[model samples]
Target: MRLGSVIKVKPEKLEEYKRLHRNVWPDVLKTIKACHISNYSIYYKDGFLFSYYEYKGNDYHQDMAKMAADPKTKKWWAVTDPCQSPIETRNEGEWWAAMEEVFHLD
Candidate 1:
């Protein structure tokens, strides 16, 4: 399955956010793979950050919980979270607002 989400990057921290992602922690990457996510990518445009990734697991929620529980991932988030600003219209409990896949081909 494919998923997409969006969030705002604080203007002041945009560079730092980019820098952190440029060298994402190895353990965090491992945890993401372990959670069955792949082809993950984040893009920046007009102060907004968009993320896309493919999910290959049967239990999405369970896998997400596992990712959230990872210590290294937690530590990574602690450093990066401040660089992001969740959209006002984002769903409750969501840091990145989930996007609807209106169209797709192939």
Candidate 2:
């Protein structure tokens, strides 16, 4: 499955966000892979950050919970979360607003 999400990057922390992602912790990367997420990528434009990734696991919710429970991942989020601003319209409990896939080919 493919998933996409979007969030706003604080203007002042844009560079900091980029820098942190460039050197994402090894353990965090491992945890992401362990959770069955791949081809993960984040793009920035017009002060907004968009993320896309493929999920290979059958149990999406369970895997996501596992990812959230990871210590390194939690630590990574602590540093990055402040650099982001959740969109006002984002659903409750969502830091990055989930996006609907309108179209895809291949």
What TM-score does each of the candidates earn? 0.98, 0.98
> What range of 10 consecutive residues in model 1 has the weakest lDDT sum?
97-106
Q: Each prediction's Cα lDDT score?
A: 0.98, 0.97
Tens-digit per-residue lDDT, 3-95, candidate 1: 999999999999999999999999999999999999999999999999999999999999999999999999999999999999999999999
Against the correct fold, how does model 1 do in TM-score?
0.98
lDDT accuracy of residue 31 in candidate 2: 95
lDDT of 2 by residue, 1-106 (tens): 9999999999999999999999999999999999999999999999999999999999999999999999989999999999999999999999999999999997
After superposition of all CA atoms, the RMSD between model 1 and the true structure is 0.5
Q: Which runs of model 1 end up more than 4 angstroms from their true locations?
A: none
